[model samples]
Target: MDAWATFWGWLFVLVLIVFAILSVAITIGGFFDVK
Candidate 1:
Protein backbone atom coordinates (compact mmCIF):
# COMPACT_ATOMS: atom_id res chain seq x y z
CA MET A 1 0.00 0.00 0.00
CA ASP A 2 2.86 2.37 0.68
CA ALA A 3 4.44 1.54 -2.67
CA TRP A 4 1.21 2.22 -4.46
CA ALA A 5 0.88 5.59 -2.77
CA THR A 6 4.38 6.55 -3.85
CA PHE A 7 3.79 5.42 -7.39
CA TRP A 8 0.64 7.47 -7.65
CA GLY A 9 2.34 10.53 -6.18
CA TRP A 10 5.08 10.35 -8.80
CA LEU A 11 2.58 9.88 -11.56
CA PHE A 12 0.59 12.90 -10.45
CA VAL A 13 3.67 15.10 -10.35
CA LEU A 14 4.79 13.94 -13.78
CA VAL A 15 1.37 14.64 -15.23
CA LEU A 16 1.40 18.17 -13.78
CA ILE A 17 4.79 18.85 -15.32
CA VAL A 18 3.69 17.66 -18.72
CA PHE A 19 0.53 19.73 -18.54
CA ALA A 20 2.49 22.86 -17.62
CA ILE A 21 4.89 22.33 -20.50
CA LEU A 22 2.06 21.89 -22.97
CA SER A 23 0.32 25.01 -21.71
CA VAL A 24 3.46 27.07 -22.12
CA ALA A 25 4.07 25.69 -25.58
CA ILE A 26 0.56 26.55 -26.73
CA THR A 27 0.83 30.07 -25.35
CA ILE A 28 4.13 30.61 -27.16
CA GLY A 29 2.74 29.20 -30.36
CA GLY A 30 -0.20 31.56 -30.23
CA PHE A 31 2.10 34.52 -29.67
CA PHE A 32 4.13 33.65 -32.76
CA ASP A 33 1.01 33.07 -34.82
CA VAL A 34 -0.14 36.61 -34.08
CA LYS A 35 3.10 37.93 -35.58
Candidate 2:
Protein backbone atom coordinates (compact mmCIF):
# COMPACT_ATOMS: atom_id res chain seq x y z
CA MET A 1 0.00 0.00 0.00
CA ASP A 2 1.01 3.62 -0.41
CA ALA A 3 0.84 4.28 3.32
CA TRP A 4 3.09 1.37 4.12
CA ALA A 5 5.69 2.56 1.67
CA THR A 6 5.57 6.05 3.15
CA PHE A 7 6.09 4.75 6.64
CA TRP A 8 9.14 2.78 5.66
CA GLY A 9 10.57 5.77 3.81
CA TRP A 10 10.27 7.92 6.90
CA LEU A 11 11.89 5.26 9.04
CA PHE A 12 14.84 5.06 6.70
CA VAL A 13 15.26 8.83 6.82
CA LEU A 14 15.30 8.84 10.60
CA VAL A 15 17.93 6.12 10.73
CA LEU A 16 20.10 8.03 8.29
CA ILE A 17 19.89 11.13 10.46
CA VAL A 18 20.95 9.22 13.55
CA PHE A 19 23.84 7.62 11.76
CA ALA A 20 25.10 10.96 10.49
CA ILE A 21 24.96 12.53 13.93
CA LEU A 22 26.88 9.65 15.49
CA SER A 23 29.56 9.78 12.81
CA VAL A 24 30.12 13.49 13.41
CA ALA A 25 30.37 12.99 17.17
CA ILE A 26 32.93 10.21 16.82
CA THR A 27 35.05 12.20 14.40
CA ILE A 28 35.16 15.18 16.73
CA GLY A 29 36.06 13.03 19.72
CA GLY A 30 38.85 11.31 17.82
CA PHE A 31 40.32 14.66 16.83
CA PHE A 32 40.62 15.77 20.46
CA ASP A 33 42.00 12.43 21.69
CA VAL A 34 45.62 13.11 20.80
CA LYS A 35 47.30 10.95 23.40
Best lDDT among the predictions, by candidate number: 1
Which residue pairs collide, candidate 1?
none
Model 1, 1-35: lDDT tens digits are 99999999999999999999999998999899998
lDDT of each: 0.98, 0.95
| Global local distance difference test of model 1 | 0.98
Mind giving the per-residue lDDT tens digits that candidate 2 earns over 1-35? 99999999999999999999999998999889964
Q: Candidate 2: lDDT over CA atoms?
A: 0.95
Highest-scoring model, TM-score: 1
What RMSD does each model have against the real structure? 1.3, 1.4
